[model samples]
Structure formats: C-alpha cells, structure tokens
Target: MLYQNFSKTPVLAAAATSLLLLLLLSSTAHAEAPMAANEATEVVISASRIEMARESSGSAITVLDSDYLEQNQVQVVSDVLRDVPGVAVSRTGGAGAPTQVRIRGAEANQTLVLIDGIEVNDVASGSEFNFAHLMNLEVERIEVLRGAQSALWGSDAMGGVINIVTKRGKGSLNGKITVEGGSYDTHQETLAINAGTDDYHYALSGTLLNTNGISAASEERGNREKDGYKNATINLKSGIDLLDNLSMDLVVRHVKSDVDTDSFLGGVGAVDSDDNTETEQTSGKVSAKLDLLDEQWHHRLSFSANDTDNTFFTAGTESYNSQGYKQKYEYQTDLFLYSSLTNSDDLEHRFTFAAEHEEEEFYNKGFSTIDRDMDVSGYVVEYGANIDDRYYATVAGRRDINSLFQNANTYRLTFAGWVTDSVRLHTSKGKGIKNPTLFELFGSTPDYTGNADLRPEENSTWDVGTEYHFNALDGYVDLTYFHTDVTNLITGSGQTSVNMPSDAKIKGVELSLVLRPSDNTRLNSSYTYTDSNDGNGNELVRRPEHVASINGSYLFSNDQTRLTTGVQYNGKQDDIEYDANWNTSTVTLSDYTLVNVALTHQLNKHIELFGRVDNLLNEEYEEVLTYGTKGINGMVGITITGSL
Candidate 1:
C-alpha cells in the first residue's frame, strides 16, 4: 500500500525499480503507435487538486502539447519552456527583446505566470512578468508548476507555476496559417481559429513578430548597434452552455511591443544612440458554474480585469510612463466525503473551498511619478484521499490578507503510494510569499526614491518523487528531488535609490524519460542538477551547474512522415561576481551546446510541411548580462487543417 495514510515507509525501492523498467519496456512494443487513449485528450488538472499524469508524483510537472506547439513553430511561452527540466530562458532583443525566465532556481519575480486562470503578475514589476507582451497565439496547452505553489496560488508562488491554457471548441470549423523567414532579419506571422455550436464555443488568435539583433560585442559587425524589434498579438475566447447546470466563460487579450536599445553610455555624449521601449496590455475574464444543492454541492464564480502600459525613452534624459490596474473576485465550493480510518485500504474523501478578492492600482510618469493602491484577501482549504488503489493523501491550507504588506500563511502536505501496478510514490511540503513592486515602492522619477518601508519575500519548499508506468511496454519514467529556501532576497542596486538583501539556496535533481525505441522511433531524455547558492558564498549569477536535453522522433510512410531532433547543454557560467565596489571585474561565460532540427510532412489529411534549424552548432551564446544570443538559423513553414 503506497503512502497509505501518510508515510510509514514501504514501497520496496519503488516496487523493484518498477518491475525492472517494466521488463525493459516489453521488448519495445512492435516499435511504435500507442498512447492515444485518455478520454481522447484534454487534461488541465492543476497538480494535486485532481487530474494527474507526467507520471504523477506530487510536485515537479511539465506538459506541453498541441502537437508540440504545431511541430515547433513555438512563438513564445518561452519557446515551450526551452526543454523544461529546471527551465531558464533569457533574451535581450530579437523578437521585441526583454525576455527573462526562471524556474526551480526561481528569480524572475519568483515565477508565477498564468493566463486563463488569470494572474499575469506585474503591477510595477513586483514579481516581474513582461513576457515581451505575450505571444503564443491562442495556446492550447502549457503547464509547468514545478514547486512551492503557496497551496494553490498566492503571492509570487515562490518560484514555479506557469499555467496557460487556451483554445476551446473542439470539432467542426478549424483553421491555421503560418509564415516564417530566417537569419537575423527574421520575420513571422500566424493566425488561427476554431469554432463550435452544440451549445456555443469559440477561439481566435493572431500574431506577428519581427527581429534584427545580433552583435553586441563580436567585433561589432553582425548588425552594428542592432535595433529592430516588433510584436503584436490578439486573442479572444468564448463559451456558453446556458442550461443543464449553468455555465459560461469568456476571455480577451491584447498586446503590443517595441524596443530599440542603445543607452548608458560610458564613452559619453552623442553615443547615447537611441532608446525606446513600449508595452500595452489588456485582459478580461468571467466564469460561472452552478449546481447549487446537489452532486456533492457545487458553485463557482469568477470575475477579472487587468490593464497595463509601460513606456520608456531617453532622447533627452527623462521620458517614462507606467500604469497598471487589476481587479478580481472569486468563489468556490465542492465536497464529498466518506472515511473509515485505519490505514491500508480504500475510503473516500474530496473537499475543496476557495474565496478570493483582489484590487490593485498604480500610476507613474517621467523621471519619477508615484501613486499606489492595493487590497487583497484570500482563503483556501482542500483534502483528498484514496486508500485502496494503493494509497494517496493530500492536505492543504492557505490564508492571505493584505492592504499593503505582511499577512501570509500557507501549508501543504501530500503523499502517494502504489508500489505495484507499475509503481508510484510522492511527497511534498510548502510555504511561500512575495510582494513589493510598484517600481519597488514609488520613484520612477524624482530621481528614484520610494521604499515606503518594504518587506515580504519568503519561501520554503521540499519535494520528493518517483513514477514509472508501463502497461507491459509503451514506456514512461520520472525522478525528482527539490529543495528551496529563500528569505528577503530582493535586489536593485544598479542605481536609483538603492536597495539590497538577498539570501538564497536551491537544490535540485530531475530526470525524465520516454521511450518507444522502435514502430518508427521515439526517445526523449532529460537531466538537471542544480545547486544555486548565494547566501554569502557568492556565485549565483547567471546560474548553470549542469543542464541537459535529448530528443528524437521518427515516423514514416504508413504513419505519415515525421522527423525530429534535439540536443541542448549548458554548463560553464559565472557572468559576474566579485563586487568590491560593485563587480570590479571577474566575468566568465563559456558554455555552449546547441543543436536543433525538425521536419514534418503529411501533405495528406489537409496539408503540412515544416522545417526548423537553430544554432545547429553555429554556437555563439550569451543568454543575457551583456546580451547577444544568436547564430545559425533557418525556418520553413506550411500548415493547413480542414473541416467546415
């Protein structure tokens, strides 16, 4: 009995290595074709509250599908999490630059970006979220949720949670269009549509991207003073089922981007070059579900709104603009119970309760402008259990109150066990918080000064895992280990009214695998080992201790053409450390391993043809901290789907 009523240890070393990897994956299932059953797809289970997969453990999860984002035409969501497994992405300019990402090791406003489930984090950068004005055109899937979720979302989430789910209405009118161009002058365009009418459903998407960056320090000729970027996006969604238990859904999104850098001149005067940065955002949401006094009692309601604007230019020393707004309301309930206590067998339990209210406002202008407003309230309760299919348990708690600062509490505990039927085991622990951003407390002008006494940044996390599934073959595997400890941790001493204090620690180990090995071919691999330390030992800049990725896919004729390839590695790092007065020199950055390939052809069921090649050994990297990251590129596209 796995995890039967908390932990008492058992599970015989993960059930004898999952029966020896399911007998080494049953001699390779005739070489391919399987995994196509699961209620015909469509899973959005936000971690422990139900819905499970990715082998299921309790923490550490990653999922990206939509034919792998249309066979890698990925235009955001940070390029599909850049091979997951302890993600980290950085960019300074190309497709509208200003992109930064992090997970596991946290930092990037401590991770927490959501769409559909709302919360886009960014009210004067309290937890960073620009996402270059969002663009992934009506996504259909993307869920990371690695660690410390504050019991179901609260504050910055302390480092993990990316949920983004879009696209509804399945069956009937479908659509697609794509275009691409390569080599520093890159160009892209996309459009999508989906519709249904059994009770009303809809989806819409639009995208446009432009690039022109290359050299920042390569003898400076890859496009001198490169400055050229642009982006645009629009998304809309709808749903209605009017009766039969009542239902409704709606969403709207908009984005704009622009960037042209060249500032902070040390050579002085005239060389100040050009500078312009702009961003605009809009968001809306509404949700309702009811079945009042039946089916275990159900009721759900939601409302949301978000608006953002940012502008920066320096042609004459002072030009800045900032604006932000947010509003939210929510309610939830669901309960089901039946227990007999006494460990080891099956019982029953499912309970949930939720309530939330939020409001935020901000304003700024020029060299410095300030104004503030905030209100937040929260509550959550959960319990889940299963004693007989091999054991499982969950407990959750959360409480939040804020008018400005301090007032947080979070808790979570989870256990899982299977021991047989393919093995399973899980463990989780949590606590989280983050708050402080409104330009870090007034001052976006006035020469920068506004700290209205700030405080609020804490975290604690622990996770352990194991998973193995093989109904005789079809392969699957997972392994996880995590630890996080953060306190205070907020920095911004690059000038402007200074501020500092950072204490951090992150531990990690992750490995995942998928294998078909033969009916055509498929093999995936992942590995990550991180230490991320900086509580005085110095050295946590541009982190990278080890990272790996491997991917392969193959399918032919009778199965309709397919080919995929991947290889990524990052190791050497330390972009800047040693600050006598403030980093008095000591920079090292040497680490590169890039290879990517993709090809798809199906010209049959409605046309298809694709191609991709990026940094295919054309290595020359720099993920930020001096910018510049590009070399070797290629793209080809074609797509068409039908059914009207």
Candidate 2:
C-alpha cells in the first residue's frame, strides 16, 4: 500500500528499458583495436575504516575520484553527490543556504559525515552537516557507504557514512591554479601548492567564491530582491616520515561564508522574511601511526576537534546565534592474522580493534548559555577474511556508553562471493543507533521543555545485491534490494520534544549499468525506487518514489579531449504543508529533470581548459516547497598543473 499512487507498471520495467538501450548501443560498435584494460580499482576507507578494494568490501558504496571530479568541473561537494543512488539532497536557496541530505529514506540527522576521518556533524544543529557550506577544495576522493553503519561508525550513522579524503604531496614542486566565471554574476578562484619527497609531504590550498542575482524565495512567491553569497576556504595537509616504522600527520580545514536567506511563512496575505546568515566552521586533526612486528601489526592514535559558530540577522529585533564544539580522542590497531592460508594468493585474514572518547558542548547568543556537556566512550572489534578464491566475509561489533543515556550495542555481518566467473553476489545485515543531540536533550526553554527520559533511536537494516560483468562489452550491471525498520523516532511538537510511539518502515531497489563499447565512448544509467511510511498512513516528507539518471561521454580528436553529458529525473512526491491555523496538509510536488554538459581539452601537459553548464534546460522547479533554485548557470576555467 505504500506505493498506491504509482502506476501499475513495476519500477523495474524502467530499468530494463534503459538497459536495453545500452545493450543496443554496444551491439553496433566494432572496435578497430583491442580495448584497454580496466582501470585499477581505488582503495576506499569508509566501509571498515581500513583501505580495501570496493569489489571485496561486501557493501553498497560509491566513490568519486579526483579525475572524475575534474572531468565534470565540480566545485561544490553537494553537486557531485546529488544524483547518487538512494540519496536525496534539498536546499532552501543558493550555494550558502541550509541543505539537507537523506539516505535510503532516513532522516537528515541519521547520516554521518567525516572529513579525513574526523566527524564533522554539528551537535547543536540536530546532528546534521550543511552540504551547502562544504567546498571540494583539495579533495582527492569521496566515498559514500549506504545503509546502517552504526556497528562501525557509531551514532549518527543509522543511515550511512560519507568520507572525504584530501590530497597530499607526492613529489617535489607541484601546484595548480584555476579561475572561473559564468552566469548570475558568479566567480571563483583557487590556488593549490604541494611539495615534498617520499620522506615528507605537505599541501596547502585556498578558494574564494562570490555569487549574486538570485532571490531566496521562489518567483511564484513574488519575491524581487537579489540574494548574494560569499565563501572563503583554506585547507592544509602535512605529514612527516619520522622514522622507518612511524609517521605523524596533520590536517586542518577552515570555511567562512555568508548568505542572504529566506525564512517565510506562506498563507493568505503572507510576506517573505529576508534575512542575512553567516557561519564559520574550523576543524583540525593530528594522528600518529606506527608499524611493528615486521609490518604484521599497525597502530594509529589521533586527536581531533571541530568548532562552529553561526548567526542569523533579521529585519527586526529577532535574531539568534549558536556555537557548537566537539573533541575526540581515538586509538585503533590492525593485525594480519594470516596472510597466506593456502598455496593460492587469494587467502587472507585481518583483525581490527578500536576505542574512542568524544565530548560535545553548545551555547546560544540571545538566551543564557546552556552550558551543557556530555561525553561518550565507544569500542569496536572487527574481523575480515577472503577464504579460498570465491568468498569474502566481514563481521563487526560496537558498543557505546553515554554519560546521559543508556548503553547501546550494534553489530553487522556481510558476505560477497562469486556464483560464476562473471557473476557475483553480496548481502549484509546490521543494527544502528543514534543518541539525542545536545540541543534536543538540554537546550529547551520554560515553555518548551526537553524530555529528560528520552531514549535513543534504533534500527535494523538488510540488503542483498548482485553484479554481472560482460567481458565482451567491457561493462557491468548491478541490482540491489534493501529494507529498514526504525523505531523511537523523536518528534517536536509545538511545545516539547518527545519520542513518537510510531515506527517507520522503508524499502527500495537500486539499479546501475555501465557499458564501454569502444575506447573512445562510454554509457551509464542508474535508477532507484523507494517506498516508505511513518506508521500514520502518511508518506515520508521529501522522499521521492522514483529517481533515475543517464550519462554518456566521448573522446574526440584525441585522448586529451573529451565531452560528457548527463540528465537526472526526480519523480513526484508528497510533502507536508502547514496552514496559518497550524493545520497540516499533504501536497504533491511536481516531478522535474535536470540536464548538464561539460567539456575538457588539454593544450599540452602543463595547461588545460575546461567548461561546464548546469541546468541546460533551465527547468524552474523547487526542491523545497517555497525555496528558489538556480536556473541556468555555467563556468569556464583554465588549469595549469605539473610535478617536477
């Protein structure tokens, strides 16, 4: 009954049709030469906090490498992840507005975000990360792991995890400079520097962005003032090879941005509220790693802190600010139990153990300082193995003890194996937990009081998928099914915040296909279908039932020149609308599609030119009910790069 509004045709039909088109496109290709070997798979760290190949991880994950980011001319982190499977991104306005991201129909706060292995979710802001304020500066790669990861990442990981890795110097004397400008009076500039040798490394980068000529409120809402935004960011990553078996690393990131936002209530004879918002966030991490026993054992100790302050200035006397602080200490070790169990090269075993302590605090500007603090201690253990040549398995467990609430335990088990030489299967089941945020637990006023006896949220998740590789076409296809049941959902009514008695159930299917018929051409298609309910016979807000995307790229003239085109479709869904009388109504937001194109050319090894256009059709649609979205925008830039 969840999908009562959808058509009689099953959603899988759409995926089948798309795959047929890709197959037809591949059939017409007759290669003049043998296709090149598949690119080497990059290592990902979010799956288990250890480097591993994606094929053997036994989890659903997506990685965007530096090369792919440069090819698409991506500047913002959200822009690169907007169309990923089982993920939905919505924002209130342009580049600097508040943005919300949901995974697999989970709430925004259910996902955990990490920058270089340091948690960045604001404890005072409902435990969510603002994607609009995150720039892709000096980023080497991004790893998105879907489904409940509480067993590995703890709280705020009930939905998934997003891990970002920054670039590090690899050789002596290397750098890049980029400048870009386009529609909406927008402009950007970035500079990067790196230098070192195998014994030491260091990198520094900075970026500036400014944009004007867009209203925070939609044109349909009859707003007329142009809202502007400004952003500045700096990043640093340095490391020293102190000894033969030990190293020290330091990473720092800082971002400051200001934006004109909208805080309006729509009804009869309503007016939009224009306001100015500013935010500053800084984070630092220092870690030391040591190898012992002939490289059979490894240990890492780290300390990190993330600080944030935000302000909102309104037209009248109503204004507010919040300051959030977090600190963490962690230690982890890895032991290679067995590197060679048999004569073959496919047998291995690894064991991991970890411990962490974290503290959080928050304050408010207008009201008296809440002065609330809480500490949590967590422990984790994991085992992974590739048994024989046909099977890989991972088992993990974690326990958390909070000073304010009761203890929690979560576990996960996963398996991946080959049914045939060309076909493989994967499945996983896990439990998840999320403790209440600081503000939700202690920042209530006299009229709206916080519940002292609140309980942590909990969930159970399971997923199964299969992958098939077509050697002739040099392509692959993947399909997965997932389900989740969540309980102890917290809800805030007008007067107080409390845990709701009802539960939520969500399920979905994800499909992805890729084909490379020739050395110069590639095709990709992906689709997702989700159905969720909140136990009140109402659909979850902002959760679309259908989403799909298509991508194609071609190399022209030479290998140095390439063109990429893509389209994304988001289906209609229901959202809650509150009237002036405090009555709620469910409304249907129309479906919409986005088109994008990008091109890159290399004049020589040291210089390259790139350009991209987003929302090619300029489709005017709202991701959030009354929020305005950027119409047509483009950027053209040139890059100079080299290593000596």
Pairs that collide in candidate 1 are 2-417, 31-518, 31-519, 32-519, 367-444, 367-445, 368-444, 368-445, 579-583
* Per-residue C-alpha lDDT of model 1 across residues 1-644, encoded as one tens digit per residue: 11122122122233234335434533432322212115532355566543544343366677776666655556666755767788866666455667777787777777878787778777765547867667777677888877788767777777778888887866777887777777678777887878878788888878788877544323122335666677887788888889877888898888888767654322221122467677788888888776532344455677777787877776634477877777667666554445456664536565666767677788887654577777767777877765643676778888888888768888877777878877788778888877776667775652355576667778788888787866545666778888888887665443332223667888888887766656677666777788877676765666677777887778786687788887878777665432334323336677788888888788788878788887688887666545566677887777777765
Candidate 1's error at 156, in angstroms? 5.2
Provide the overall lDDT of each model, using Cα atoms, as 2-decimal numbers.
0.68, 0.80
TM-score of each: 0.31, 0.90
The number of the candidate with the highest lDDT is: 2
lDDT for model 2, please.
0.80
Worst 10 residues of 2 by lDDT: 29-38
